[model samples]
Target chain A: MENIDFSLVDWSRAQFALTAMYHWLFVPLTLGLSFIIAFMETLYVKTGNSEWKRITKFWMTLFGINFAIGVATGIILEFEFGTNWSNYSWFVGDIFGAPLAIEGIMAFFLESTFIAVMFFGWNKVSKKFHLVSTWLVAIGSNLSALWILVANGWMQNPTGMRFNPDTARNEMVNFWQVLFNPVSINKFLHTISSGYVLASIFVIGVSAWYLLKNREHQLAKKSMIVASVFGLLTTAFVVLTGDGSARNMAKYQPMKFAAMENLYVGQQNAPLVAIGILKEDSKETLHKKQDFRFQIEIPNMLSYMAFLDPNAYVPGIKDIVHGNPEHNILSFQQRSEKGKIAIRALSDYRNAKKAGNDSLAKVSQATFEANYANFGYGYYAGRDVHELIPNIPMTFYSFRIMVGMGVHFGALFLVILLLTLKNKIDKKRFILYTALWTIPLAYIAAELGWIVAEMGRQPWVIQDILPTIAAVSQLKSTSVQITFWMFFILFTGLLIAEIRIMTTSIKIGPTEDLKDSVKN
Target chain B: MKEILFNIFQFYYQGFKSMTLGKKLWTIFIIKLVFIFLVLRIFFFPNVLKSNFKTDDQRSNHVIEQLTK
Candidate 1:
């Protein structure tokens, strides 16, 4: 721990966060719009409507521009896994690299190939073939999302694998368990559906702006109608899967859920904080007398969300950090103690094996097996694991913002959905304005969701299995700092270019006809 | 469904076959992508963990020493 340079870790984190946040800005739109464009292309093929073709091509043009820049930044992550977190690469690369490699071979290749065809196949190929290409591109993009998230989920709950001390890494034993991990599946659904919601909002918001401008009424209205209906369905799925995600969190990482709610003491039928602000650090509050300065909580909602039972006992940060006898929750100190023994036993076992002392090796193996579950905490030998608690204030607020934004998006889409049903969307000026304004809200919520997911799980690179400190590469902090700023500045310029290109394309609306522009 | 996919694949195969200029351009694209993603990766990013410890016993020993240190 002392050998790990703090600055190096911080700089590497900053670089990864910068690239990930930037990568996300483009990805949700790509994931969501790919499906929307496919639907539009299907409409064109089915009804033989050139207008739908125009609409699809128009969105496709924006997608292409975004896709190019997204690829340019996306490559940075794969490189960083080795360069920035070299230890992490070696430690878990056995399991983690599988999904990434599969993503490249299966999803990335499929996506890049069909995307070329989807973009350039217009005039060259038959309309049917072109339509197929569009759908394949959508599937390819979302499939790419699935594998990456599966990897992330494995980190959150390291199931389907076993630690091999000899190899000094986690190795996968059951690919199916890794693939079908409850957390991974739920996260995939929730994340991809959120993307759909974001795309819906983007499309509807842009269309509303056009409606506000009194231009492209047909395209705007049609897009708004399609996006709103689709947005509503996806939003519903997002909520369902979000519940599954929270429950998974409560089971595997209760500390995160406790932080999200700012609950200091364990309680039966724990209330969910709809919105709350943390109080100034007072001895009483920190020690579990009272936690929040102000809060609006719904009775039993947190318990319900976590366990599907209103009366289920939910552990809080205090209960979790300290041993809770009644709930049988081991304190961080206890786990830390056990983890130390496990780590030491592994060392002893290695030594005994080298010396050909079978009896000593067997005893060491037994000790290692007994305490292996707490092995990660062994690294923080002299301190309580409670000290490793994530930033409560940041995690708490980010969780609320994500949930609050989700509710707002869900409601906004439903209103638009209802209005579309009534065929009165064009007349609703207030709704149109709200839709236009809420576009940024969607982006904010999307970013906040990631903040909550990543930030809330902090101090651990892999939840309960590996702390971030142990995962970073031993490298000069200054080099990482230099690259962080380099990427930051470069991505900032790309963002400005992306915005300019997208806005201009949207303003131009669908090309008059796909005839001349469809040149191969 | 398999037959439909096969037909689609055939269409693409023949489409690439007939286009002399497009085929040449695509070949370059494939080569560049493979070089950038695969070839460069080996030199720039070697797995230090795997290379440093030659065996399970050695790797385990290193972890133990580091943790205790």
Candidate 2:
């Protein structure tokens, strides 16, 4: 191979990452905020309270601003995937393209069409129809998330697919397998719950601010109660689903799990490290035997999650990185051949798993060796067996932060729930401020969690199946850099405009309730 | 039918007349310029057309093959 410029890949990756991060700043709110708005409208309808109605209208105005920016950011993502990662488009386009198309045709169109009715037809439509429209928008956003999760999950687990060298791609070998892939369902729930957490916290925070200022006190108090209730439920659910999500990661993506957990190789019961400085170069041991960097004793945590057996072996990151000697029966060329074999083996294993043929799915050492040797372009792309394993330090820290926030929010949610139930929410001054502080923190946690998930799976855009270096577009660094600058300017302007609009709307207070509502 | 056509013509004619013809012509010129810009965008800067499909002819062929298959 010729001497490739690594800087090209680095610059392009940075540019795409920046744009994606900027776009995401608008997305989670659109997902979660829309749902809270709908729920608030539901309360307004149920209670026949003008305060609830006003609160709903205020939130809807913010939601409208968020939604507009979300649409803009979302549009940019579609163009960007092709612009920034043309090679990824060619490879996974067959399987990945399906869900995106479905999302556009089904979810996005549905959401956009009904958004007008929901926002504009408040007076024109009946209360029941308006409420239904609100719900529809929420469902549309989540449905959009569902299809997107499916695409992303496929990259993590790579189910329902087989590689076609002629196309240099993995095509959908089974539609059902792709849809019901192990990671998709868990990821979808996890993503939606995070969205809810973000949405609820935003509501609670804004409402608390109003309550603290003693402006719209009645409306603020009621809104805070509703937001707290939603926030608490979703936050608790996010934590529970988070464990399930991690376990799911362990099951289908053991390498990713190993990286996240900072494991070395197949070993006995392992401890869950709560916090520690990860010295990647240093070596150590748990019980004065096995070599490792950092070790602890929690007795059977890894085995319990991964294999459901305390004694079952769980591989660590180092062991996976420096292959196990027990499985060392292959030449370099043979190992390259075996990589291709392993893919087929995995495909067969998946097929057997679906068909309930465990005996047939058990691939032999020879088969494994052949597949290990010939990992094809994946080998050249540095997705060789070693690098397919995740970055232990990065993954470990990322996973912990995500889990820690999940726990923190879980506790915070319950407190809100208890306070709201007792009708003592508004009275608790510190609690109100805590809810307010949570708003920005919740968004920050989500952004961090996503970075961990995506970045932890780095060097591969499509998990083990595709390397990141090979996946980026063939565009020059200057082109991507220019576009990035342009988007940065545009998005900043849009954000300032959105804030100005929101301030004016809040100041005006929901179109004077009736007369000015008609005038507008 | 003729009366309907005449009414439609008179409506736009009066609308333009109310704008005192010069302003109406300027608006027309701007609209034409926008259309020309859009056409040029499709030819020169395909990104402005804003589909994720690659701008190259190979992508067009690939898309056709995908459709047929």
Candidate 3:
């Protein structure tokens, strides 16, 4: 408690964030693009349309580039668990490693092996076989995502695992419970559906560029239609999934929910902030320091969103940190005290075994079980309980930006679809230009959403059970610093090269591919 | 073998030179990345894992003891 190391923890977190941020840049594109390519290939097989095959090949080339880069950054991310967060790894590995292992053995192989077939089997295999390969690539990639999300979801809200004092680690007791966590399902669907929106926007943007250039007209028109339709469907799912994700956060991580909305007071029928700014001079606000400045709010929306009940009493940041016994919620300090009890009980149980006292051991074990739920609180008990409340302003703004982007994208996709229907896609030059630019905005939104999820869970890496400070590897900060630089250099170089190659390939276009296939 | 290699090099050489301001973009990109990842991290972030516990067992025990307290 007296001599806490801050540098090593900060550097390790920085390195992990760097790798994850880079990995994510490429992943959503791959997740969404794979399905688009598969659908195109399917239509090709169904209608025997050569144009469809060209579209598939054109996008396949880009997907390959994105997937290759994703793998490059993703490998670094997985290794970080062992190399940087060894303590968390050993503590939660029993339950955490299952989904990751399954992802590797089942999902990774399905995507990777068939990906080769999908890319190379165009001339080498039958049409149906190639189509199947394309579909497999899509299925495999999404399944891989599902498992990793399950692993992440478990970290966010640990369940199906029990702490063992003897081994000083948690052990898995229920695989099904871990696999089917509501947070995991919501996270998986919301995340992948966002990927779908991103991919559709990417497709539509590229097609829009082609229409603007007055090149590849027929191919561009059809691709835009498919992309716009795909965007529409996925954006619809994204809204529903986002709602589900917010609900799950309220249930499993009420603190995050409170911070995201910047709610400071416990109340029934809390209004959701439509848009608001945090008071900069909070100390001057005197009584209500963290309250938002002048803003728009929809009354009862937050309560209805968080809990289906319109009058459900929602606890705010203050209520969460202090006590809200009226709602049967213990203050964070009380939880910390309980966590300490759990820990002491476990220690007593261990000592009891040494003393050959069976009844004492049984009693201590029962006590440990009763209080273990607050185990994470014990680590932060001596510190300011207010620190358990994450960065309110950042979480609030990031959630708003992410949600705002999703809404804008949903509307944009509809407009694009309407223009396509009118058959005046090219005539609408201003909208076409807007479509071209929305590509980067979509990526920004996706990243902001992740920032909200991750940064909003600050202080705790394993939510309520383990603080991030207690979960890091016991390695020198210098080593992590060096590796951080190494990855920064490597991933950046790869990203630049990838863009150069991808843009060049895109500019070259699908015409040559069609000709080459026709000749063959 | 040398001729084939030369042809490959020739292809990439032209490709690189064909793009305007390619070198300038690369220079800016590398500079910004170094500043963000290395320079900025030094000023803004500090390593927290190194100061507290010297060994793995010590770290685990510290956490356990704290929880048990």
Alpha-carbon RMSD, each predicted model: 4.5, 9.2, 6.7
lDDT of each: 0.80, 0.66, 0.80
Write the residue-wise lDDT of candidate 1 on A205-237 in tens digits. 998988889888777878887898889899999
Second chain TM-score, each model: 0.52, 0.42, 0.43
Candidate 2 residue spans exceeding 4 A from truth: A279-298, A325-337, A340-378, A381-391, A503-520, B1-69
**DockQ of model 1, rounded to 2 decimals:** 0.23
Give the TM-score (0 to 1) of chain B in model 1: 0.52
Order of models, best TM-score first: 1, 3, 2
Instruction: Pick the TM-score winner.
Output: 1
For residues A342-460, write the lDDT of model 2, one tens digit per residue: 54554555456558776765553235334532343224433345434445566677677767776777677677667766777777889779877877778778877777677767666
Number of clashing residue pairs, candidate 2: 26
The true-versus-predicted C-alpha distance at residue A132 of model 3, in Å, is 1.0
Residues A1-520 of candidate 3: C-alpha lDDT, one tens digit per residue: 3455779888988898888888888899999999988888888889977888888878887887677555635655656775677667667857877787888887657976687578656665689888998998898889889998998899899999888775567889999999899999889999998998999999888888988999888777788888888999999999999899989899989989988888888789988899998888787432233866778999999999999888988888878887888998888889989977876788898779779999999999999889878877877768866668787778899999988888888888899889888898889999889898999998999899888999888878898888877777667889889878877887788788768867886788874467665554
Docking class of 3: incorrect
Q: Report how far residue A275 has shifted in candidate 2, in Å.
A: 2.5
Choose the strongest candidate by DockQ: 1
